[model samples]
Target chain A: MDLVDFARGPALKAAFIIFILGIVWRIVNVLLLRHKRILSEPRRSVPVALLAGLKGTGSRSWPHPEFIKRTVTGEALGYSYHIGLFIVILLFAPHIIFFGSFIGARWPALPNSVVTIFAVITITLFVAVLARRLGHPVLRHLSNFDDFFSWFVVALLLVTGLMATAHVGAPYHTILGLHILSFDLLLIWYPFGKLMHAFYIFPTRAVDGYVMTRKGAPS
Target chain B: MNTSPVDFQANLAPEEAKLGESARVAGAMRGFAREIGALSALRLDACVHCGMCADACHFYIVTEDPQYTPVLKVEPFKQVFKREAGAFAPVFRWFGLKAKITGAELARWQHLLYDSCNLCGRCSLMCPMGIDIAELIEQARRGMFEAGLAPKELYEKAAHQRRTGQPEPSDEPYRDKLLAIGRRFNVEIPLDKPRAEVLLTVPRTDIEHYPAAVAALVRVMAHLKADCTFRSDGLVAENYGYYAGGRDWQREISRRLIDQAVACQAKVLIVPECGHAYSALRWEAAELMGKSLPFKVLHITEYLAEALEAGRLRLRTAQVGATAFHDPCQLVRKGGITAAPRQLLRAMGIEPRETVRHIGYNICCGGGGGVFDIERAATLRHRVVEEKFHEIDQTGAQTFLTTCSDCRRTFDDGKKRFNWELTPGSLLELVAEHLQGG
Candidate 1:
């Protein structure tokens, strides 16, 4: 088989299987671990506490007012790139067709030009994120191979997908094969690396919120 | 009140010195494994290393040092989780992606977990992933404690508290101290009263250093005609066990107060101006007991605020101008007693000039999490305190007030050390000074 055929067939199937199983394994490993019982009386009702947990997921998405001045650039860059990724991955036409094939569903997509604009902006933001991580003392100290590798995996997908769409560096099929292959790598790594934060972040925030809210202090 | 500083280092036990490095590493690993419950596991898994949490740490903010980053402090503990409990642990081990934690690392992290972190929950609030970095640091402390790597001062204090139900430097019995303060102030500090409505407790700091606060509490209770009593068996509100990460000792220390409150058949248990004490009881005590506390737990400020709101206690307006209130980290951020203290201040007819980051996001007093007693941490603690002093000064307030005795002591120490103009005052004492019809 040619590059695109190999990437689209066996490689895609294997990566998809690993992605799903890896996610389930990670989640179940965490879920089945020992959980501390909350024996303390909650200040709010169960419904209110649950609501606060849901609220926490959204509330922590932005910086608190006190931290905004110092954190606005990081917050803005993070939010901007995430929004860009969502638009490019979910709202783009070809991407929709690719994702739709798996879920057996289809949805309207943004124009290719609009998707390209978002992709460009996202790539720029990703670069800025890397620069910040390397330049900032705390970020530089906290970063590990997992952090930098995770950035490279995601950024590779973005850059290759853009190249495939623009027909810039190589032939169309070759660029498309590289894009699909980059995606497969991402799928394989998603559940093992920091990218799993996509699944873990909201729930962690919600749990913390639920706990603090029960103490009458919702984070 | 004894104004003299007690050397906590003098109380250290010699047993820990016997453990070899290998044994220490094994102990810390075991402790880390034990602490990794589903909630903490989830939190550990959720960190994206966005580094926003560094801005929220008082230590990192003050020192601008990457090593002081709150999340980095727990790296060794998190490393333990990833290697032993994570889903990809086998693969990670095979590839050497995550290495085994060592005794030397735990020793280095001892300062990060105990000296720098206040367990203030500020970084927890700031984390984009909502990782609860403070909670992880607390877990890290547990691991450090198991390794016998906890600062000698904190460990000794916890051991003393676990044994005697009070921390060190008490020359007399706690009951005598209470009785003496009551007699000196001409207020009745009802001790071990049967079937009281409220069970009151004091930190050793108040009984030994700030006795006026104890007197003030009694006067206020009398003015309100509330049936509150201090039980000698559970007189202490401080929990060095909680500070030092000795869970068993923490539970034992908390159990004394819980049992006392239950025995008195009190409806309310009021924690004094001790932030960690309040946190130990109000948040973690029930969990530690494996059951809910029988009575309601309220900070002294919360109880006072409730009384003021209900018209049971009245206070005359004071002329203390441009007063700035320091929100203790545990009481405000962790306990959610933010509004109560401000409400009491308002009840006393003073509008508090808030610090730059007041309420839930307030900075720690730098000496919290028992760092004040850790002699080696003195210089770093002072640096953190300098930042707090600058924040309070910027508000241009004449009187500085706080709700935690530890915060009070920190500020008092800072005042003496730096010759700062403002001496920290307690909200409870201020309330007593303004009692309208006592």
Candidate 2:
């Protein structure tokens, strides 16, 4: 089969199915686990605790002031690349066209030049983050195969997408097919790897905040 | 006084090292899998490992050790969770990637789970992903305990508590010493009172080493003319089982207090100036007992703050010099009794000079989570305490005050060792000294 046919047919379909089902299965399995109830009387009401939970989901996106003072570079690089990746994946015209094909929905896309800028900034930040992870002792100790593999897959996706957009390396369909295949690989790896953080972060923050706020602490 | 941290005597008889090599790893893995409930499972799954939490940990912040990172400390737990219960467990097992925790591994993790960590919950506050790393560390301790790999000091303490209902095994008898303290203070400590508005209890350490702390509570109660009694049957506020990670014994210890409070018809059960004791009673006791407690649970600081706020207790201005208050990890950070001690200081007409990190963000005293009881942790404890000492010194206060007895003891040790000029004092003792006359 041709690269385009394989990328659009078996690979895309398999990756999409696995990605959705894997995420849904993981979420369901986790939610189905027994939750040890807080038997003690909470200092705050349930509504108040839930509100605190929601607040924590937003507030924890920013590091604490003390941490920010020490980790300004890490935090800035981390957020910049994350926001850039979000925009490049969802808001770029070609990406939106793909999204429209997949989800039957598409919003107005950013201009190609702007998307190119985001891709460059994101790629740069990703490299900086990878270098820091390799350099910093704590991060190095915390990192493992999953961390590196996830970084590698995401970086490959970005590079292939950029290559397709710029038409610099190969024929347009060939580059595009490679980009789609790279993304497919990433989606297949997503639910099993650290990429699941994209889905778990908000609920995790909410639970933490609810528990802390119920004890009368500002989470 | 011996200047060496290791020179201190062990509080309990040393436990025998009798763990075998068989199924201990399986036992630990089972415990880890069992303890990973919905919340903690999410925590295990959600760690992005940015290492920002390292900045928040007292051990990592002071020592700069990569292994001491809060996220790193939970590695063993994560490994077990991944091998047995993770989404890719089958793949991990098939590829020989499973990292089963062995007896030796558990022994090494004793330092990570016990000595180095105070389970202070500061890292929980710092995580951008909002992982409760401290709570996960506690579960790791539990898993270690299940594998018969807990520190001998903690097991001995828990054993002593289980057998004698006191924190340590004493030759002189703890009940007699407690009664002597009540007699020395010329106060009626109605032990096992049939009914009382408040059931007051103290840690065995307070009765043995700091009887003055117990006496101060009595004096404050006398001044307030409050209906309170010390039940001899459930006198100890400290929960060694909770510290040792023995869930059953922890429940047994808590049940002693719960049964006593229920039998006494206590409207309020006041835990002494011990942080973990307060946590065991106020937070974990009901959960361990599988039901809500019949009476209210309050740390001594909380009770004092509430009394002052309710206009029942009054304090004369303290004559001491400017003081800095240390917030205990369990009481202030984890337990959320932040405002009580601060408000009490304000009520005494003495404004406490605040530390650089104060209130909910206060650093651990380096001796919480039973670290003070571990002799091997002494060097690390003393070393990391300098950070708190420097922060307290920056406040320029002549005296240091804290609500938790363990924090006070830790600071006192650091003060004497470093020859720091600051005098460590307890809020309970300070209140007793300045109670309004009847």
Candidate 3:
């Protein structure tokens, strides 16, 4: 089989299976672990606690006013790249068609040119993110192989996807096959690496918020 | 005013000396394994190493030291989780991706966890992934305590408190001290009164150095005409066990107060102006007991705020010049007692000039979590105090007040060290001074 056909057939199927099962296994492992019962009285009612949990998930997304001056650059960089990734992945016409095929439904998509602009900006932000990780003393000290590798995996997909779109590297089929292969690597690594934060972030935030709110201090 | 500096450090315990190196490491690992509940597991899995938590840590902000980063301080604990209990543990072991936590690493983190962190919860608020770095650091302290690697001063105090129901400088009986203070101040400090409406507690700091605060508490109870009493068995509001990460002792200390409240049939258990004490009884006591507490737990400020709001307690306006209120970390961020103190201040016709960061986000006084008792941490603690001094000074207030005795003590230390004019005053004492009909 040709590179594109193999990439779209067996490789893509294996990646999808691994991705779904790995995510489930990790999540269940965490959920089934020992959890201490909270016997303390909650300051707020159940409904209020739940509402606070939801609010916390959203509130923590932005820095508090006191922290903005020191944290705005990192926060901005993080938000900007995440928004760019969403546009490139979900709003681009070709990418939407690819994703929509699984659900048997199609939605309107952003024009290819608009998607390209977002993709380029995202790639730049990714570079800036790496630089910040390397340059900031605290970030540099805290980072590990998992962190750098996670960045590489996602950045590889973006770079190869851009190359395939602009026809800058090899033929279209070859570049597209490389992009799909990179995605397979990401799928395999997602559960084991820090990339699992995508699934864990909101839940963690909600749980923390609920806990603090129960103490009458919602962060 | 007890202007002389008192050494807060306590002697090391004999058991700590008996722990061998390898056994200490095993103990630490066991402690870390025990704390890996579902919530902690999720928080451990959620860290993205973004480093934004550093900005929220006063230790890192002042020192600019990468080692002081909140997340890095818990690295060894997180490493223990990844190797022993994580979802990918088997895979990580096969590939040797994560290493077993070693004694050397735990020794290095000893300073990071005990000396540097205040467990203030600020870093928890700053983490984008909601990792609760401060909580993890507390868990890390659990490991350190288990390994007998906790700071000697803090560990000794915890051990002493667990044994005697009070920490160091217990030269005389606690009841004797309370009676002396009552006699000295001419305030009625009723002891062990059955069926009292309120059971009040005091911190050793107040009893030893600031006895006026104890008198103020009684006078306020008298002014409200509330049936309140102090029990010798539960007189302490300080929890060295909570500060030192000895869970069993923490539970024991909390149980003393809980049992006293129950025995007296008190409807309310009022924690004095002690931050960690309020947290221990108000939030953690029930959790440790495996059931809800029988009586309501209120910080002294909260009780005062309620009385004023209900119009049962009236205060005559006093000409206390421009004042600033320092919110204690455990009280404001962890206990949610922010508004009560402010409300009490406003009721006395004094509007507090707020620091740059006040209320729930206020900076720690650099002495919470028992860091004040460690001699090695004094320099670092002083640097943080200097930063706080700047923040409070910027408000340009003549009088400074706080609700936590530890904060008051730390500020008092800072006053002596920096030769600053303002001595930290207690809100409870301020209230007692202005009681209209007293």
Candidate 4:
């Protein structure tokens, strides 16, 4: 935690306020704005689709599968990019330490060797997805401004996670400061962009289940 | 007796009539935002933009319009939800592909739903993401409808539904046509029949476009001595209103049918050939009426299954040669009447080869959600059936059998558009046409 000096008392106080208020506003916005359909059953079979999608059918799926059939090459690359991103976001060393110190009591972090490998994989996977969105004619037509922002956020997340690693770059707090700043930006930016899909997925999947069962679409 | 499709604008004061028609729109930003947010939260990370859904879309393949890409259909709203995902999300809002809402932007929803999509379940067949674009279309329609924008055709249909107790029925000299048909069939075709064993509801198309499907049903009932009758009140149960995002209109249509059935004190109610009508009556009408139906009901195919299973109604003509089943979008996607129709086909001793995409995975006839407007019909209802056309061809079946009148009409159009030679017919007609009558 070498950058403890950079986390000036005023900065910690400000970041702390942003984190709390940002989260509250976000929760309120999502909760209030969401078209609520009180749950009757779990929605789309994301778990079932993900399991089936893991090996041969990754890229062609939405988050859960069904609707259209996709090519093997695309599904594989898609799963690789997303799974890598998930690990990077959820298990990044700094994120782990932050959560561990607060929740786990002991910081069980990914070894530095493993961390480097994940960063490389994540970057490659992300670039591959971005290329498809930009290069493919159909996807290109479908993509808009927020799609690029999604790419930027994903790229920033991986880079910041890598740069904020222990003794990896310009000491901890300076890099961590950028990470924190991006995060604050992320919290504020989330409600109005494609990133909001994160909160919407569960219910969307639920609706899928309801409709599929209602319509009797093949499992 | 007027079962033909009527042009609603015909009755309108030239200007209002000329307005085509649309559904209700309530400009509720909070609800719309949440709708977008829910989709974004679920799929933003989920879609890798693999382009797998491209082939799943009939319109995309038919026109090769890049905008017809399935992901593009709802992606705009997804972007909006992402911005609202967080404080930082606002920063990403500028990255959204779908534009911010406007009166002009909202106007496009009609094209998207009625023109662009046909409520088919084909994409669901291929979607690894399982993103239901059909349902999303409904949401978009609702969003726009609430905002005071609706397609002229749908608005007119809804108005007619409120007025006539049916969305597409004509007020022409159809009563004469009904009487002639009754005389020709030599059956008691009761118009406003009092009490009967069953209350039979037919799509408005039966009274005009494809009278044979209805005629075939009437003949079968006559031979079986089944005391069934037709009613001009709530004569049509096709709920393109529900498809067009008009729940109140849909409820009104349902109420009329239920009241008609109750008025006749029918021991049972039978829905013929129309898929959405079957769903609207069996599933939605009950809910809309705030009670279960007074009498039991069955789809014609389901009713046929019962008769065939009972060994009471024998098939007169055995269906020979290969056949394929095309499940209607609403019947398969909304109504849950898959195997019963197939079973009816099999009982007639027809050799049935299932389509590559069958049952719930069947593509919509592209006529659902009220895309019946002729102006934008070209763009909205283009022959997006290469997959289905191919699937049917693969079955080596010249006849495409389904349980929906809407499918019958759309498939006929699709056949002409795609140069498909296969003929679409009803499941019950097949049984009646080939039924082994003793």
Cα lDDT of model 1 by residue, A1-219, tens digit = 999999989999999999999999999999999989988777777788789989998988877889888789888998899999999999999988888988999999999999999999999999999999889877777888889999999999999999999999999999999999999999999998999999998899899888888888748
Using lDDT as the yardstick, the better of models 1 and 3 is 1
Clashing pairs in 3: none
Arranged by DockQ with the best first, the candidates are 1, 3, 2, 4
Tens digits of per-residue lDDT for model 2, A39-137: 998888999999989989999988777667766877898889989999999999988887898789879999999999999999989999999999998
> Where does candidate 1 clash, by residue pair?
B273-B405
lDDT of 2 at B217: 88
Over A1-219, each residue of candidate 4 has an lDDT whose tens digit, in order, gives 444444533455565676567546655654444453322221235465344334223332343333324455567776687787666666656567765755775545676768668888888888887888778767776665567886787687677767776446776767877766665556545554566555544444554554455334442
Candidate 1, position B4, lDDT: 13
TM-score of each: 0.96, 0.96, 0.96, 0.78
- The docking category that best describes candidate 4 is acceptable
Worst 10 contiguous positions by lDDT, candidate 4 chain B: B1-10
Error of 1 at B359 (Å): 0.9
Better of 2 and 4 by lDDT: 2
Q: Give the per-residue lDDT of model 2 (tens digit) for B1-438.
A: 000111222232334355466666766776687688788788999988788888889898888887788888777788887777776678777897865566665666677788888889989889999998999999888887777767778888888897778877677777688889889877666676788999988877678778888888888887888798877788888899988888888999889888889988999999889898988888888998889998999888888888898999888888777889988888877888888988788888889898888888888889989898898888899987888999999998987888778887888889888998887788899899888873
B1-438 in candidate 1: lDDT tens per residue? 001111223223476667788998898988888799899999989988888888998888888877877888888888889888888888768998777777765676777788788899999888888888999999888888888877888888888888888787577888998899988999877898878999999988998899999998888888989898889899899898889888778889999999999999999999988998888898899998999888999888989888988999889998898999999899878887778988889988889998888888888889989899888888988998998999999999999999888999999999988999988998899999999987
Tens digits of per-residue lDDT for model 3, B282-303? 8888988989988899989989
TM-score of chain B of each: 0.95, 0.95, 0.96, 0.79
Q: Which parts of model 2 have CA positions greater than 4 angstroms off?
A: B1-16
B1-438 in candidate 4: lDDT tens per residue? 001111222211233323222322125244345346543344443453546667677777666766666655554344344445544465555655233544444444445445677656555545555566655655555554444455666766776777766565555645556666667766556677788888887777676777777778887777677787877775665765666556567778777777888888897888888776775676556655566677876778777777777876777545456778887776666555667776776667775687765666556666665665535665446565545677789888866787777777777777787888878877776676775552
